[model samples]
Target: MIKIISCILLVFASTYSFACKDPLYKDKYQITNFSGYSDVIVARIITSKHNDDEMYSPLMSFDAAVLEKIKGALTPNQVIHVSAKIEDPRAACPLYFKENSTYLLLLERQEGELQISRFSFPIESNNEHFSSYLSQVKSGINIH
Candidate 1:
């Protein structure tokens, strides 16, 4: 009975830990579009599982609104660094992708191209930490 209770508690703790911190979590992923949409950068995550495919499937999309704001405060063509907490679509599926369940992104526009310079994740789940990290990333960039 004690063992059963301990296992139940463990499962509950793990589940609570896995919940996302920010409802508006955003991730930075590299994307190159020649459509003059560089001013409006978008983030699309491609699963590692689909590496062999020519096209990258977008897990989600986020407008670089925070990055835009940062740019507005800085010089033209200035690089803006920001982080967004990304959701794992595979978390719900038998369709798991890679081992790391979350990712962070750093993005900028250079020479009419939107570039994602960084993508990584934390060791554990923390929604507040994720949101704060993204906010810090947004604040670091000179969006103007």
Candidate 2:
């Protein structure tokens, strides 16, 4: 009876999933962190390519037209390419992006290319506070 109960407890504990992150809100730390990004831009995803070869996690590649350049060397109307790996839905932060979706992304320059790492969170274009975050970062008055 003890072994059976322990097994059941282990199964339940191992199956517990943490809630995913909500990209709508940015605290003081988030604002500061976004400011440190190499490039911060608001762009509309013109195209998206999905790759599922890496097992459960799905990879997404995007080509977006730069609409606003809050910070960075990106020019207006330029096509910025970015890619993200949508992790398991049960993970704390699984980023989902769609073609034609607008997002405020923190892009880092790597090897002469812009890339989005697994830890980056792309804010939705519709987020009301998107502008606020940009302003804070741009003015360098964001929370420390």
| Per-prediction TM-score to the true structure, in the order listed | 0.27, 0.72
Q: Could you give candidate 1's per-residue lDDT for residues 46-125 as a string of tens digits? A: 33332234223322222222222222223333343332223343432111223233334333455534443212232112
Candidate 1 off by > 4 Å: 23-59, 62-107, 110-112, 115-144
What lDDT tens digits, residue by residue, belong to model 2 across residues 1-144? 999999999888766544344444645326455544777777898886666564333446678899878778998899978766334454544455777888777788766678775465667767777666666666663323
Please give the RMSD of candidate 2 to the true structure. Answer: 4.3
List lDDT for all candidates, in order. 0.35, 0.67
Lowest-sum lDDT 10-residue window in model 1? 116-125
